[model samples]
Each structure stands twice: as C-alpha cells, then as structure tokens.
Target: MNLPKPSLRVVFLLAVLVPLIGAFLWLALTSGPLAPVPVTLTTVEMRPVTPTLFGVGTVEARYTYRIGPTYAGRVRRVEVQVGDRVEAGQLLGEMDPVDLDDRVAAADAALRRAESGVVAAHAQVGDAQARRDFAGAQVARYEQLLLSRTASEDTAEAKRQEAQVAEAGLALAVANLESAEQDLVRVRAEREALVQQRANLRLIAPVDALVVSRDAEPGSTVVAGQSVVEVIDPSHLWIDVRFDQLGAGALRADLGARIALRSLPLDTLPGEVLRIEPRSDAVTEEFRAKIAFSTLPEPLPEPLPRLGELAEVTVALEPLEPAPALPNAALHRRDGQLGVWVLDDGGPRFAAVETGARDLEGWVQIRDGLASGDRVILHSRVPLRPGRRVEIVERIPGLPR
Candidate 1:
C-alpha cells in the first residue's frame, strides 16, 4: 500500500478496535453472577383450581332510599349522620315544620268548619222538608174549605199562594243546603291534602338500613322528593362488578362466588350471582354483574365497608377434578409460543402446553400437552435445550395419591 499519513492510519485502526472493545465490555458487564436471581417454584400436581373470574368492583347496597320531604321546604334538623343506621319509618330529619304546622292547623280548622257546615246543611234540609209538608196540608185544607164555602175565595187563593211561596222557599233552602254540603266536601278534601303534605315534611327511612350519605344540612332548602339522605338495606346489599366480556364468559347467573373485603383480606363472604347486565357499556366495553350476599355481616369483625369501596371479587368456578396443572416458574416463553423444560430420558426436553386458569397462587391449570407423571423443572435459569441431561434436585413431599 502507498505510504499513508500517520493520522489516517491511526484513525482507521482505532475505528475497528473500539467497537470490538465496547462489545466485549458490554457482554462482560451483563454476564456477571454476583447475585443469581433466585426464583421459587413448585412441582406439577393436580391442583384444585376453583375456576374463578376476577373482577374489580365496589361494595354496593341492594336497596337504597333517599329520604326527603314529600312537599318542598327548608331543612330544620338532621337527626342522623352519614353512617348512622336507621329503621323503617325512623325519622332521619325534620324540615321547617313551622310552615307545615301552620298548614296542618289551618287544615284542621278548615275541616272543622266544613264539618260544622255539613251539620248546618243537614239541619236546613230537615227544616225545609218539614215546612214543605206543613204547607201541603194547609193548601189542601184551604181548597176544601173554599169548595164548601166555609173559607172566602180570596182566603183560599191566598192560602194557595202561601203554599206556593213555602214550596219555593223549601226549594231554595234545599238548594242552599246541597251547595253547602258540596262546599263542605270540597273544603274537607282540601284540608286532607294539606295534612298529607305536612306529614311528608318529616323525612323517614323507607327501610331499615344504614345511612350511606347525607346530602342536606340544616337550613338547606330541598324540594319534594329530593334525595337528602341515602339509606340502604344492609341485608340486601350486593356487589356490582364491571368485567371484560371475555372474562365474563366463565360466569353465569346464580353461580357460586366468594367476596373479599379490601380491608378484611382474610375473610371471604359467600355469595351467589344475582344477574349479569345484558348490555355492555360502549365506552368501557365492559358489563356489570351482580352478586347478592347470603346475609349481612353482623358486627363486622373488621371495619364496616362503605358503599363504594373498591373490592376484588372472584367468582367460584367449577373445580377441575382431573385437570393437569404445573408450577408457574416452569412456564417459559420461546419462539412466540409457551413451553416448559421437562427432564426427559435424553436430557431436558421442551414441552409445549396450554394453560387455562390460575388462582393467583403458584399453580396454574395446564390445559394440554402434558401427560401424568411427567417430570418438569420448577424454576429454571439456564437457557434450556431441546434435549439436555438434568438431575432432579428436589421433589415435592406428599404428592396427591
């Protein structure tokens, strides 16, 4: 080669060696064994995987009631707080009963006036009827007297006129009585309506339940039927879970389930599927399913959960009696498929298997590709070969008979 400049020669030499040196140094740093990642695993066994569907939701009340005035008014007093338990018809709060009291009193007074008017009307009816009978008798007597010439013709005519006047007066009295009676009826009806409206001013619990929320404070103006206090029947409370459609396939209406409170992780409540909301929400692509607890937890051992405490719910799926299962650590990803290292006669063999359900424990249900009594490693670190000799380090004690 022609004599090259020293800088050119040095730069060319540095370019090739620098990359090789960097590659070796990077490999050396990654291959260090200072602390081997220790992975704990278990051997394959027939694990009783209670097939379960996992869904996150909150504890909810099955029966909720919002207590408010049937007639709108200002809240005078709130007897209970948000967490207070109340019974059916128990007064949760009271509204400004002054206006209501005045209304009730006015209603009572009107009713009394109406009743008096009715009595007066009845008395007028009796008087009108008696006068009518008396007038008829006098008219007949006068007519006979006139015919026998015992009474003057003018006198007979006058008696007949008096009878007609009495009849007209009776008719007027009867009409007045009917009108008074109708007025009384209407007045009494109006009074009753006021009474009902006043009674509705006292907010009461519709069912025996815990008050989940209080929407109004004293002096707050609330409308009739406006929700002021939220009450829920603790016994009828249920969980509403939004689950992916694919996850929902494993569930059914009335299927057995187990519920764990977020606070009380150790305890599980027995429940049954109440229903699956048929329609999926378009935004979330999820549907809600409900499960009703068999009974309300009494004197909740731990803290009592609120209406919307996020919870993890697992639907109790049918147990796979004879389904194959394996240690979770043995599951290895390879060539875009799942495989596991099995100790074969030739050495360590790669077995392809499909998995079904997992219990969040170390065991997972093996759906396919593994036979009974097949030996598979629990945890592996070394890159496994299709056929490589392996030694069994430990076997699980008390394997299922």
Candidate 2:
C-alpha cells in the first residue's frame, strides 16, 4: 500500500526545523555554557626548592643620637645642618647660657676670697705663736728672779697668766685657718660644677655620623631632653623588616638577603640578616628582623636613604631536598580542604593535598596526594568541580602573555 504524500508546507517546516535544532546543539557544546573551561596546566616535578621569605621594611639607623640640651633652654646656634657629615666630638649646636657664665664667675671669685682668708689666717697663727713664746720666756725669767729673791711672786704669777692667754689665741687662729681651707674646697667644687653645666650647653656629636635632622634652629626654645639635632651612624644603617609569621619558621641571623629600596627600584642591594627580634607582632601576626647591608652603596646614594624610607627584602632560607612540587597557583581550598584541581584521563578533579614549605619562585612542595608527572591546573577561566572538562592553553588571557 502507498503512503499519503506530505504537503509542501510540511516539507518546508521540516527542513527549517532540522537545521535550527542542529545549530543550537552545536553552539551549546562548542562556545556556550556547556563548553569546556580553558585553563593553564603545570606538571608536578621533582626539584629542590629554596624557600625565601619576602617582607617590607623601612631604613633605620642602628645607633641614633639625638643631641639636645640637658636643661630647658633656647638654642643659641646650630653648627650642623641636615645631611651634613660630622666627626666624633664635633660641636653640633649650643644652648643659651642665660647667666650661666655669671654663675661660674661668681664661684671663681668666692674661691679666690676663700684662698685669701686662708692666707690671713696663716699670718694670725704665726703672730699668735710668737707672742706665746715671748710670754713664756718672760714667765721663766721672772720665776728664776723670784727664786733668787730679786723678783716678787706676784710678778711671776702675772707672766704665767699672760702665757696662757697667748696659747689660747694661737689655738683660735689655727681653727680659723681650718675653716678657711674648708670654705676654699667648697667654693672650688661649685666652680667645677658650673663649668660642667656650661659644657653641657654645647651640643656635641658623640660619634662619626650623618646629621639626619635639625629639629631646632637658632633661638628656638626647647624642653630638656628634646632633640635639637639628630644624627645617625651612616655606616651602621639597617632595615627594620616584618615578615608573615607563617613563613618565618626558618628565619635566623646570618641569612643572605636582597634589598630593593622604593627610591631606587632598579637597584638590588646585597644584604644579610643581622638579627631576629625576640618579640613578634601579635596583632599583625608578623615576625620582626634586622637586615644589614653586606656592602654599603659606593659613594652612598645621594641624600642617603632617609630614615623610615620603605624597602622590600627577600631572605634566602635553607634549601630543601628534591620533592614533588607544583606552581602555587594550582593550590585551592574547597570545603575547608587544601587541594588542587588535578587533570587525568577521566577529567579535572579536586584532590586533597598536604602542602609543605613554599619558595619565592611560586613553587610549593607537595608532601602527599600528588606525584611527579601529575598534571594540575594552574589557572582556569572559571571555577571547576569534579568531572569538569577543561581545554589546556599556553597562558590565560588578562594575564602576562
């Protein structure tokens, strides 16, 4: 039996509908939501990784000297300006004397008077001694005359009393002399103290240093202990760096480092870890360290690194043995698990990984859940899940080509 022939309209509708459905399916599978995610892949390789800690720091002086007056006073004159190199014991500035000179002069005068008093007392003692000797001689002569019946007993007794009075005067003169000497000593001590106070008024450099700041100028009044001139040991500059505590387990003194100053970006100065601070920043969770230059910059950078200038530091730690490792970019956290999106014949799947130390070059050591030659996704166009399909690419768009 022959089947009924379809109409021309039906034949046209059938032809259009078939190609439309085919195009929709092709678009969905190739370039639409159902398409495979594009990604960059890296292989886990066996290699040694040199863990390095990166930190930000500021230039600081190991020894900072703040020159100021010991007493509150006005600045008289400043001998050094900011950026000036100074030698040890060089005078930096002076404070106003404000009658201090007069005080010292008065003490000197008092001391001189004391010395003159001492001289006068010595003369009195000598005169009193002579009078005592004369009176004693007269007493002996009168007693001898009385024994020979040529002088009376009253005369002899009177001479004896005169001698006793002379002896008392001598004792008094000697006591006066001791008083004058003590007064002289006290006056001398006051003069020396005044002289020392005068010396303190002059601000002097304590070491060979570079003047970093001049906080006060001529005629500026400052309180005691306030800084007038600030100097630092240019040869002993260091960076006060802070690194994340999580990555500072191996940090220690004597480790080599590279320093890049914000002012001099292109220059990488060689440095080393001078010391690790005993205290850590509890709030920021960072460890503090001091990094010193292995060799100071030749001729020292013009306008030497200002105190508090920013710097970037990278410290090289101990090298690790060869182990399975991959780019840190492959790491991911899913449902509180540290893992990576690993690619296999089946497809991309999340594999929980136990990670070890990471290095500055973006490589992380894989302790478990990965092996050498395993492929992992480094960068993906979209978030991935288990059984997700991916298309490998040389590099991802929007990143460095």
Candidate 3:
C-alpha cells in the first residue's frame, strides 16, 4: 500500500513536536516546576496570649439614700419629678403646713405675751424694792423713836409689825417676778422649735443629685421621713465588678479597663479601677472591683452607665508568653492536618500547623510553622498548593466588611 510518505503538513507537525518534547524533558531534568515568587500578605495575630481574667459588675450611685422627713406629715406639693437634677438646699417638696403654721403662730403669740409679762415683772420688781426700802426705813425710825421715847412704845411696836408685813409682801413680789421671767424664757424656746417645724414642712434636697424615682406625687399624702423621690448623683456613678478571688490579685486599683455596657453595645467607655474591695461581698461572695469612668464619652446621647445595669469589664494585660500567631484566614484543614499558607521566596507554600489558643481578638496562636511578625494571607479564594504562585495587593482603604 502506497501511503503518502511524509507530506509537507506532516513534516511541519513533526518538526514542532520534536523540540517541544525535548524542552519538556530538559525542564523535567532541571527542575520539576518553576519556583513561584513569594507573595506579600498582611496578617494580624496575638502571640501566646497569656491567660487573662475579666470581671462583670453593675453601675451604681456612690451615694444612694432614701430621704424623708424627720417628722411625719402629709405632703401638700411636690416640686420635683423623676430625672430632675437637684442641688443642695434646693426645695424638693412641701408638706401640709396648716397645723405647723398654726403652731408657729401660737408659739409666737405666747412669746409676745411672755415678753409683756417680763415688762410687768420688771415693774413689780421695782415696786417691791421701793416697798422694801420704805419698810426698812420705817423699822429704823420706829427703833429710834422707841429709844428716844419720843414715840409711844405701843406705836413703835405697831410700826415695827407693819414694816415686817411690808417686807414679806416685797419678797413675795420678787419671787413672782423671777417665776414670770423663767416662763418668758420657756415661751421663747418654744417659739424657736415652732420655727424649725415650719422650715421642716418645706422639704429640701440634702445633697446634689439627680432625681431617679418619685414615690410622692403632687397632692400625695407623704409623711415626713417618707421617700418623696429617689435621687442619684451621676457624677458619683461607680461600677462594682465582682470577680473570683483567683482573679483578684491581678486587679489593682487604677488599672486601665474597657467596659462594655449593655445599653450601648456599640461603644466602650474607658475607665480606671477605683479600688478593689479587700473583703468579698457577703451576698455575692465575690471580690468586688470598683471602677469609675474617666469622663462620660462624648456623642453619647444618654448616660451610658445606668444604675443597676449589668456590665462587663475586661482587664487588659501584656502577654506573659508569646507564641507565633497569624490571622485565622490563613489557616485551612487538609487530610486531618491543620495547615497554613505561608508565603516564602517561592510564593504561597502549604505547611502543617499546630494551633494552641484562640482569642476573641481574631488572633490564633500557632505552635508551629509560623513566627511572630511573619506575614500571611488574610483571606484567599483558591486552594493553596505547596508551590503555587500568588500576587499580593495592599488593602484598599474605606472598604465595607
């Protein structure tokens, strides 16, 4: 059979394959595959995160008191409502003053009458002194007349008896005057007490605080010493974070803390540890850590720390031990092996990894195949081969998650 030997088309095809096969053989002998240039990737991780402890507590007013009156009386008018800021000596509410006002007036009138009595007593004293002098002089005159016999003995004796009677009357008048003076003093004291009662009827705030709760409404019959309103000083707000005794030693006063409030989840307020209670709370049986905000965060629409609200406090610490860490995105599982994509001089390389701990900070500590400050890919779409080529681009700014 005559096969068309080696046509021009067949020759051209053979010619192309001959060199291509040789080149392929040459590449296999030299290197199996060309090395991939290392990719530059940025990653974030925490070195061996030493164990840290945190505490959760409630915010409260440093000075919380239930104010009431010393004496019980019906409330007539309430001057404040819940959430009102009050200053020291600011009037809060008024009690019914009908009875108190009447008592004050009566006491004042009695005081006035007593003063009049004092004047009358002074007059009586003067009169008594004059009578006493006259009586004494009459006795002297009687004695002299008796001795001279210028006056009859019976007449002198009668004058002596009359002078004795006048002296007794004068002493009685002086005693009456002293008694009236004392009565005046007592009446004046009662008037002072009445004045105090009148003042008490007008209830006033005992300290600077914000009113929290108002138990007494307008026209509500609130007795003295009853709670008209509950007030708290926002400036004096503090947090009590209870921690176990195990975590107490690390927590010192004035330590920097980050607090997450339940009300405002988006924001965190910076605070300092005010103090740590040496003794654990009796009810909670946990060590209490007190913290106060440096300043209320600006742009906050309302008070971030509400009284009696649950809050979480995290005590930040420097790592005692450091382990190689990388961003979680660089890790993958293959054939029951946890592997990470590490960029080397030959681009992205797959290496087995041993992970130790993971923190909420998105950092995973690696026990193997990574070092601190090593750059790794954050996120990659394609599967990583041992010697795959890759290109890295710096992260763009202002990108949405």
* TM-scores for every predicted model: 0.74, 0.72, 0.63
Across 268-350, the per-residue lDDT of candidate 2 in tens digits comes to 99999999999999999999999998998666767877789999999989999999999888899999999999777758988
**C-alpha local distance difference test of each model:** 0.75, 0.92, 0.74
Q: Candidates 2 and 3: which is better by lDDT?
A: 2
Candidate 3 global TM-score: 0.63
Give the per-residue lDDT digits (tens) of candidate 1, residues 1-401. 89866798789989999999988877655554322222223456765776668787888877777778877789989999977878887899888876667777887888788778778877877887787788889889989998899999998888788788878878887887888878888887887887777777778788778877899999999887898888887777788888777646767798877788787789888888899988878888787999777666566433456678877777866666766787667788888889787665746667789987776555678889886566676654455566533444444343321
Residues 1-401, candidate 3, lDDT per residue (tens digit)? 88777889989999999999989988765444442332337554445664345788898888886766667667778888877778988988877776777888889889899989888888887887787788779888988988998989888888778778877877887888889899998998889988887887777788887888888766666655678777776677788888867645566776778888888767788888898887887676678878887677444336436788988887754454766677666678878888877777856766787876555565667887766677776554345676566656554234211
Error of 2 at 58 (Å): 1.3
Better of 1 and 2 by lDDT: 2
Model 2 regions lying over 4 Å from their true place: 1-48, 126-167, 320-323, 326-351, 371-401
Off by over 4 Å in 1: 1-50, 98-100, 146-158, 223-227, 299-302, 318-330, 342-345, 355-383, 392-401
Q: How accurate is candidate 1 locally (lDDT)?
A: 0.75
Q: Number of clashing pairs, model 2?
A: 0
The residue pairs found clashing in candidate 2 are none
At residue 265, give the lDDT of candidate 3: 68
